[model samples]
Target chain A: MTATQLSPGRVRKTPAGAAAPGRRRAFDRYLNPVLGAVGVAVVLASWQICASTGVVDPKFSSSPSGAFGALVDSFKSGDVWSPLGSTLSIVAWGMVISIVAAIPLGLLIGRNRVLYALTDPLISIMYSVPYVVFLPMLIFWFGIGADARVVIVVWSALFPLLINVIAGARNLEQSHLQVSRVFCASRLMTLRSVAFPATLPYILAGVRQAVGRALIGAIVAELFMGSAGLGYVVQLKTSNFQTDDAMAAIAVIAVIAVLLNHGVAYLEQRLTFWSRTD
Target chain B: MNDPRRKLVVDDLRIGHWSRRSGTFALACDGLTFDVAENAFVAIVGPSGCGKTTFLTALAGLIPVESGRLELNGEQISGPSRDRSLVFQQASLFPWRNVVANIEFGLKAQGRLDAEGRARVAELVELVGLSGKEDKYPRELSGGMSQRVNLARALATDPDLLLLDEPFSALDAQTRELMQEELTRVWQADSAGSGKTAVFVTHDVPEAVFLADRVIVLSSGPAHLVEVVEVNLPRPRGPEVKRSPEFQEISDYILSLVMSQNKPGRRTEDHDSNAALSR
Candidate 1:
């Protein structure tokens, strides 16, 4: 059966004709950035106006100019680089650990029913519990340092990666499995040739989800216990009534999160190009 | 050790599953015996729920035989092996692997080839008329193309016995016909050097007649061999052969046998009449 038959319910339509090149290009150009700029401009203008008119206290809710000044000061002082580097490093390490652990475990659980049954309830319970609840326990175990932060990041990110990978492996077509059997493929050959490639898309989707969760876990853990990181800076500024500095730090975190999410998405698309066409 | 004349023989083969409540034999086949000669194409045609697939699976060693014995190359049949390959009704090509990679899978499995495997894969891809689609994954292929890849994958290993289970049933009428012709051509061409045996299963009588040297008509559930009709049609068969009188005659005979089996009480009436006449 064709992909259309395999996946029923969606009605696919082809474009009737091609539009003029210039018009299409223009449509693409205006799609996102224009809307984003407009959104940013409105928020910044409203904040500036409210703070200047004393409608909102400048000390509590910093003006756009105050936030920009904080942003500039952080850059000039060179302190921004170290914290940003630390946050990225934690996220990277957490992701690496997640990938190494989750993919093989997912495949193992997916292929064997008994293993799946044994782990199913445990994974469900663990996944359901919020990661924040583990932060105190993690700190007690690893102490208030990078180790504790990394543990929290791993906890938050591991589930999505594990679940998606298992889903991918579980849903592989029985026909393909039969084909593998007919060939008398070795266990390793089947895993590498049939199972791995088939499960890659779902694994990538899991990674995409993990990226977002990892960032959240890292930032939150840092806020609670870190001495030097973007989250730590934000927390320190908030305590000292430096609202502008905290806002600047928050903005940097948002940009980093967007970038990381998009990066994973791009890699997913490149790897599973066949999935989209199908 | 290299015997090219080996034949598959089944003697008094009985196959059944455990009954849900009683845990006893649910459906049994008794005194069901047949011999498929080397290089022969045998087709099993019967109504749905006839246990034709069950019999094929038994022969392929996919299911355990409850009683009697089955032999491949004069040795007792065992579990699934590379010597016998199955083509399912659906072309179960690995969606993740491209056409060439899919075809090379079997070769890779057997540890049979090296850099030369690529050349062999290319040749098979060309033989299947999928020359330009080496890099195209199964998802991107049409139903016919995917089935072609499935056929190619099976053939790549040069299996001694090829079992096809309604392989063309999912295609459109025209595509099915084309695929049949393509399969015939491939079989004829491939058999030139190394002879291979094929057992095809189908519900279509004409397809059975067109493809098989012998058509085995099976009785409904707990299936047994009802009749075995031989086709004397010449090799390198074309679409024109399907219109021949001999082809129609065999097809009609098989159709009647199938129809009679479907009607309740017909077998009893015929048996009773024959018995009475003998008395």
Candidate 2:
């Protein structure tokens, strides 16, 4: 009764006989980026030094500034945007398709023992085979068109999302499920209230993996008989012995991948806030 | 000692699970025949692995009965129903849901939750002494606080029979004692109004004696009802009741019964006493 009179926040602030909140390590939040920046600076400096001192052949290795110059040149020429756009579109659609298809399938498989028994082996086999190894088959089937690239991206992205989602559903806490049953909750109600929210953190984790794989899939697909993506630009430039231009394209792709991953991570943190605190 | 308005009846009930690892049926409890009168607080005590949880699950209709009869309010208990709400040992509050939202979960599931339901939840929050912590998520709560939310949530549905499975076992001793007191208060509150019957399961003898009007003891591994000792101690029980001679005597008696059941190849000294009581 006394505890109720004070706000819950103050109750938390004024720890009773219960456990006190654990103090975070010094500079916990800022330490990661600060250390990361220092590491990146060292790598960049070493690369610049190597390129400048001619320790590595310029034909094979472009200095950071040279790559930057090529990046500006490509942008000014107005030719890079379309390829960049194509790559982005491919990744976006591929991830969307994978997520939409995988989550429901994962839920079904996770919930249904019969369905899981029947398809589990097939799923495992498909997952085991590196999806990129299917590039030749995809190109042959879809004939080097955007269809082939999209298929490759979808294939690459699908398994991680599916596996993680299945895991999420499968690993649902028995106690939570029991709570639902005790209430006589409908199946749909149980799914919405317990299963879906419980699986969210796992699903977000899957998305993180899917984003990385889908991006790689898009680029890899473009490398094989494609003409309108950043990967194509990189391939085209490299084959023509334009290492700086190829490096520039690679740089853009890396930045995009990092940003996309960070975006998903931020969303994951916001949505599954309980996981962090718990 | 007997009431005409019986809320529950479990006669010759045999409960078990199919052990896939061993490919055999494992019995948890058999011949669990008992009647809980309306508004009675019944506590079940037994050794660890005595199917206390399994018994609760059976009452909740989570697990199917192998061969037995279970009736609630003159109706056959077939499956999990909203009429019987359960509070698990762990708080089992949805990690994603805040305290108030968790309390509202059962109401929301039944679709009976409305603006008026908010007041019901608020009442439960106060009843469990968790009024201010309504918005805090389960993660933000200590073990005792989470279990309070769990109890509040169970009470939300206004169930006919409240099934509890050692709901305070996970808390520290002090917190557990506090929770026991809180539960007695809540039960007293419900006692006057709906007369909600509760079957509380625990291994703690003192806890059983303090809260229950009657404590049912079971033997482990294919658990059988061994004894049901009535606590003649005064009600509106507080911490002072725990120190009373009557409370200590009953607690010691149940402890002796439980300890005897745990000893391998030892004769049960209270067997005749239990059989005579049942008769």
Candidate 3:
């Protein structure tokens, strides 16, 4: 055989090879987490520096180390566990109630023109009203037990889920519905196959927003009227001048919110695997 | 699959739509009367506003008919049924389902997606030249590939009649031509020996002549059935046959018919001109 025939340079590289650099940069999977970590580190370092230098009063603001020390002390004393468990359970049940009530109602209003017309104005009016403003009245009617707390939580979180699910169902493509019809799909079959999957992404987006509202609801109800839960602990510690403990509880709340948001976002990404974000 | 000999009969059919903008019910297709023999490839060709799509959808039972009798295999069609499958202008593959699952959709709907049914879907995936792409999603496919999946999904149910409404109109010229050839092969592929019948709608004249056994031309307004021209070209025809004089003549004839229908009140123009000159 000739030397030219065996030479590695004789074979041309594919266009994909030439395009590899830009393509690799376009979707470097590590870029997001690395940048996120950098951003979080910068925020924490600045806050720590401000607290240690007395740029902000450490007594009121509490330094990062002070809050971390308080967190460790609360864990050892077993004061954080019961409150945390109670808050988690209440928020979980409230979300469950809201989802069950809202999904069916949203579907009904979304699919039917007459039903949508009838309910849309009322929904708008209710949504515009600040649900947090009703806490005092709720405590008056139901008393400051789990009932009132759960009601407040559900009330705050329901609208986002309802509105999003309605938009998702209403905006379902006519062509997709027509595909089911061409196959002679029944109404139930069409709902199960086409409408459900189409609404999932929107529902997940709603849930992401609802998580923040639910956390706020739990905090507000517990801090203002209830005698238990993490919000109560934060309020008690703050009023008693235990600023570090209050800051630590608030930090935990922030962490919980972040975790819940990320969890739903991950679920959305997995379910809508066919969608192209870029 | 139930009776490959099923025929479609439309008698005095009228299709009307309520125009929300105009607040009027405009008749789209009026007094449309025709019969499609079993296993015949029929193409409906006309101008843009000719309601060819309306006619196809009416046959599919998507729209309610104003007045007429429509029958398939001597049975009345009041609603959409698996007996007649439709291929849309856009592929309309479910974005959430992968290629194999998209093809399996109809089978699942019919509750026939057993082990054998899955095997049939695999065969269809191969038949459409998408064997290696069985797990790929619709967004990952090119326009032609997606339409192939659409065609396979329609055939998966083994419907007696296939309704196509400009299925390749969205494709580019080169891809459209290749898809047309692929479609002809898939339709004629008698591996299962179903002998599926089809009714296609398009505004493209050459496409009508090339892929059809008979081309049905319609008038511009209200889309009255203007003429039905038989395409007696030999079978196994390819892009090479497009260069043949016979194919060109047939294409020219259909184009002229469409052009004549498109021009309104042309026959009375001379009389109006003579009167104006005398005045």
Candidate 4:
């Protein structure tokens, strides 16, 4: 064979195939961030124009500048950080609890047909019943504290994570499992080497969706019962007719959701780099 | 051509399975017996759905032998072990693993190799002519290259008996021919002093004739060995041997047996005679 035939890299570098390494690198460095910034600017400009021109009442549809002004005032008032911190802490703890509890349950249910069948009805019922309706009962039990908010967040996050993980684990190819058997891999080794890695992308996607749901759950719980958090602040402002402050809190929640989704996506990309190339 | 010095023996092997969807026992093989001698390359050929896969699986102990005995080196085969290695038709390399990692799978399972396993993996990769593609994933490989990796992975364990189930069936004709040559080179290298035994399954007549010390033709399902034709052609055999009259005669004889079995009630046709000679 010639040197060109022996070298796999040269074959990949050929035109009309995948992009050259140098070109891909350049695109990564120069184009992605610029395009992202332009996208954000355009959305903000449209929002600002609509609000400032009174396409809707400024009282209801707060401009980008109006929301920023409210954010600055809230910061000056010295109470902003505590509520934001509280909200973040609840979200973080709730996510940890959800992951710890849901993944094992999902794997168990995924692998065993009997367990899955037994739990199917209960999970469907839990998923169908909006936890918002159970807020009063939760307050009666946990008494409107951070614990209660966390409980609500867990309720919201658990089912999607459970369902996706179960599906992922169950969907593992029989051929891969046969390979494991042929090699006589120990049960633990098979789970670690084959089961876990294969199901990681699906689990990561579930976590992404769960993070958004958890935020909504936490905020909703706080809105109904608590005197602190971004949701509480929104409730307080809206009740007092401070529409700009309420909209600002809502905007912050949107930004938080976007950031969490993107963060999970980045983690998924890193964990499943092999999958992407394939 | 029954060999007196047999390295592996399967006696009265019967393999059948009850189809879960159809709820009927589908008989794949019935009353099959064969013997492969030490350092021998034995090829089994049959048409599609002729229980070729089932027979190979039975020998590898992947499927349970319903009522038969499979002896390897005079020991009754029980289950999959390090002593016997199989190369499947599809490469079936773990997509998550790279080439080197895949080759080390059996060793890792046996817990015989340590961190120094990379050295042995490098040797096999070189043997398969995949030296620099060690870090490449299976999906990155072409069909031929992936099959090469599969062959390397099976050989890495250094098994006494190698069982290949139509291992090169997926490659194109040209690539398949090249791979057959590569396989012969590898087999000869292994057989030099070690006396490695191989059982290769294929449907291609020329492939069986080129690669085997003996070619065993199986009848259609319920399949059993119809003939075991000894190929006394000399090696290192080249592409030119395929054109020799001796090669043609043996090829024609095996093809006649296979064709005759396919149409048991009818007189053998001129098409069968011409087709067998043409290849």
Candidate 5:
């Protein structure tokens, strides 16, 4: 009764027992970016000094300035788009296919005893073995093309995601399950309402892992096969001894990796916001 | 059992299951029979491994009735139905959902969260004293608060029969007492005029006496009906009612009944209680 009462023109908005986050959030927001910039600046400064002082051959290891210059030049020349687009497209397609295929399959395998038993060994083996070992067979089957690259990405990304979803579906709380049943929710309703929301934290985690692996798979595929991607760009530049261009492409790939991770992390924050704080 | 006005009838009910893991037959309830009048608040109490929770689950249709009649409104209870709802022991709110969304789950599950249903949910939220906290998540709420949401969620559907499974047992002593008072208030507020029939299963004798018009006591494991004590306590009761002589007398009688069923003196009730809770 005391907790419920509010004076006129007043409100109680903060969650019980949680401190106000406004001041702390602002400090963290600025502090992290400042700290990250300092770390990156230190590394770049060290690299700049070594290159300028001729401590190592710039021919073999490009300086931060050289890479930065090449990056601008490549963007101006417009050749960066082709490889970046190709690699990104492959990752995008692979993720779409994997998500479409994995969620339902994992749920079915998890919910059904016979299916889980039948697939457990096969899935474990598939997840355990590196997809790098499958490159030769994949090329043999699908050839060194965009389709092959997408297939490899799916191969690498699907299992971690599938496994997480299976766990989420299988580890349902007995009380939650009972609540759903007592409400007489149909099977579909149970899945959509109870199971899906409950599984969200695990699913988001799986997506974070899957997206990281998918990017890695796409790059590796392009590197091994003489393909049209940032990986191939890095390969071609290195073979030509254009170390600056290769470093620039590497820099672009690094930015892409960081951006992809942040994108998924932001999604996790939005979707599974209730997970860790509790 | 054959009363026309009886809202619920559990006649010679036997609930048993074949456990594949143990390769044995586990009998929970044995030839139990009882009747609940329409809109009456009935509570069940027993010793630690007694089948009271199993009986409540059977009434909720989460567990199957092995034999005899377990009927609501004269229809045989088979599986879960929309006419009934259960307030689980744990709060069991989806951590992802805010309090309002969790309360709306029952209506939403049954495809009845229309404008009217939404209004009813809002009403229950207020009734349960969660007015300003509708958007709060389960983790943010205290034990007592979460159970309020649980109770509100069950009531949101306007179930004909509400089954509660030791909803306040997990709370601390003070919070549990406060919640008991809150529950009675919410029950009356939501029911408004003619109340809904409710069956509360608990190990706490005081809680059984405080909440129910009738308290049905069961024996130990393989539990059956032992006695049904009618509590003629005045309605609109408060926490102070627990200190009254009449309340203490009823609670003490039920407590002794429960204690007599225990095999050993203070035999690890906390540890083995989980079995009875989930039965």
Candidate 6:
């Protein structure tokens, strides 16, 4: 209302000593990208030199330029979509199932001492052990179908999310719960409004972990049992000695992984912005 | 919601908690008997770790009465009810919510965030001197600002009784003093200017004297009734009221009572006894 006082949430709009950080801010903003680009360029230049100079067989070790050309070729020929779509769909479905099932189940288990006791050892084992060891059994049960692929993805993704949600729920602040109790909130209201929001930072953290695991699960499934997907494409092309195409598919996987990670990180920042100390 | 005869009764009250670690009962308040009349501002004071906080908490229906009659309007409090709200010692605000949303939490929780409820919330935001700061998140607020939000959230519900547990204890000296005055103003201004029943629990002798119609003193841990010192200070009081001789006399008396309860060698002197001697 007053000219002197800016609106709420805008209190931090102008930091004191603003004149000082100008150069530092500019340096911080551009330094990372510029350095990253140079690092990448050097690696590509070295790889190209090795391949063209016959230091390594191009058939076995594809050059960065060759991979890029093969990538462009695959996209233009419309041969990239089917595998890409398959892998993405499996990851999406797995994430959906993990999120839906884990949050409620985690909260329920976390809140109840008896249930938490019953499941703690089981969950710890599942989360700590490599999911790859279970792949053979899952394929035996579900038979390399899309169902098996989705199940594998969920298997890899679900435990991390569940663990995080449970930890978050268990760590609910006593004071916050007291506020809810004093207000006479209904059980459902307490769960939805209090417990859920209090646990949001943890939930987002879990989601970040789950997304990475989900991608790994999808790729591993495709590599071993998938007749479709970029992972399968990479495997098949490598066997055929078309290393350039194989490297191109691997490059696509790397891009997907990076994009997915960045997307989750962005979401975490937006959703749990309040939790950040800085 | 108004009943002229509405009152809180605590007759020979006992409160305790069962600690599973030791598998034994830890008594908090033992046979503490006192009653707060309709719309009276009552303060309970004692040494640190005394059961003042526990007693106030029991009155809010957060902890069950182990025995004796602890009733509001002649009904026993079995659990936390909508009739009372507590201003916690720490400003336990939800960080995700802005000041306005945090103030609106109680109303929203009780499914009472209708038009009138929103209006009251807006009024409380102003009452607590947090008008322009309404959109600031908890992380964005200072210690004093967040406590204002905490007070507003409690007041927004318009409960029959309000319980405060040393709400200003965490603030710095100057801010605490300023807030104490703000509290007196807000307490009288809100609830249609009638000032609803308030039970404030604090270890601050001066604070207890400055605010309450009656200051109930409790002895250290497993607290029992020590003395019920009624403050006969005039209405519409301010910080200047604390400078009055009557305020000094009363606060000194209460302070001596509290200091006496502690082990004889524990404190050198926590009060201005020179003023007491001069008086």
lDDT of 4 by residue, A1-278 (tens): 00111101111122343555887766756686899999999998998998888887878777789888998887889767888888888999999999999887887787789998999889878877886888888889999888888998998988878877777778776666656666667777787787777777667877887898899998998799877899998999988878889887887788888899879877876676556542
Stretches of candidate 4 exceeding 4 Å from the true structure: A1-57, A75-78, B1-4, B190-195, B264-279
lDDT of 5 by residue, B177-238 (tens): 88888888877877444467899999889999999999999888677888989999999898
Model number with the top DockQ: 5
Model 6 pairs whose backbones collide: none
Query: Per-residue alpha-carbon lDDT of model 3 for B139-235, expressed as tens digits?
Result: 8899999999999998888888899989999999999999888888888884665456789999899998989999999877476788889999987
Cα misplacement distance, residue B138 of candidate 6 (Å): 0.3
Q: Which 10 residues in a row give candidate 4 chain B its minimum summed lDDT?
A: B270-279
DockQ values, each candidate: 0.40, 0.47, 0.32, 0.32, 0.66, 0.48
Q: Model 4, DockQ value?
A: 0.32
Ranking by TM-score: 6, 5, 1, 3, 2, 4
* Native contacts recovered, each model: 0.71, 0.84, 0.63, 0.39, 0.90, 0.84
Recovered native contacts, candidate 1:
0.71
**Interface RMSD of structure candidate 4 (Å):** 5.7
Candidate 2, A227-273: lDDT as tens digits: 78999999999999899999999999999999998898788878877
The TM-score obtained by model 3 is: 0.89
Candidate 2 local distance difference test against the native: 0.82
lDDT (Cα) of model 4: 0.78
- For candidate 6, give the docking quality class from DockQ: acceptable
The C-alpha stretches of model 5 lying farther than 4 A from their native spots are A1-35, B1-5, B18-22, B191-193, B263-279
DockQ of model 6 vs. true complex = 0.48
